[model samples]
Target: MQRYRMALALLGLAWAAGMAHAASEMPVPSALVGAWTLERVDNVYPDGRRVELYGPHPQGLWIIDAQGRYMMQMVRAQRSGFAAGDKSKGTPEEYRAASLDSNAHFGRISADDHTMHTHIEQASFPNWNGKDGNSAYTLKGDELSYVVAKPSSGASEGAHGEVVWRRLP
Candidate 1:
């Protein structure tokens, strides 16, 4: 009788521990629900040298709702102008066209919160115009690290970089 009760108590404790472990492993989508800003960008050059690129402190906001709807908005600092590859300049018509072309280049967090995908459009060189590339992200707490790869067109081959972001207050 005493032995039987001890066995049952151990079984119950084991079951509770299993439940706790499972709960900890379960991915919570709400954990990533907030605004984030680009803190720093670490670029890996082809020569195996890593370079850090600092932007004009671009601020980005990411919102994830319970309905699985997500939206992000990023704006560069006013004092810091756009990069050479930025397609948001020129005449009004040109800007409109560029914005439309680059609209799909935004980033979105996966439903599992394990992956983040970002798209970027490149139209700088005439030969490489209308080219888009994607980057994959791995998140750790409030930090997100991404690896970006350029498309293969012989124009800008093997161009890759990693960017890290932190959740804003």
Candidate 2:
């Protein structure tokens, strides 16, 4: 019966090796490498008010490259309670100021596709600048979620926000 036992052990070893090879050949998902448009943004105010902003207010574009380069652009919506073109027109100085403000909300994904860092150079709300915030991204199936956190100054812990992106065809 020693030969029989040896034959069974060899068969088990062969089966394990075949399973490892199959696992290594598993395919990576293809949904992740493409461009996605921002469909909705829900902002929760500090006073427990939730606002849903939609329509052609502004447009956003996000591109994810297979080589791991990511970029995004978002335009701000026009102010409420005022008709279009009611706000200050674009003078050279006004243009310069708006450009500076636009630069603050942009962000980039790291080369490794693991970290997303956003900088707020100047905030319309008080006391938002001079601080850095980042999110870590995890890929599962076709959805990517980022958990954002900021630094605290002993008063309270930093706030957290989750931004989810769905892969586009």
Choose the strongest candidate by lDDT.
Answer: 1
Superposed model 2: Cα runs more than 4 Å off: 1-32, 39-60, 66-69, 73-108, 111-134, 151-157
Q: Rate the local accuracy (lDDT) of all candidates.
A: 0.50, 0.48
Top candidate (TM-score): 1
lDDT of 2 by residue, 30-149 (tens): 444577655443343445543333333444566755543445544445433323354464556555444432312322233234654444454433365544455677766666766545
In candidate 2, where is summed lDDT lowest over 10 consecutive residues? 102-111
Cα TM-score per model: 0.45, 0.40
lDDT of 1 by residue, 77-143 (tens): 3332344545545566656444422211232333344554222233333433343333556778888
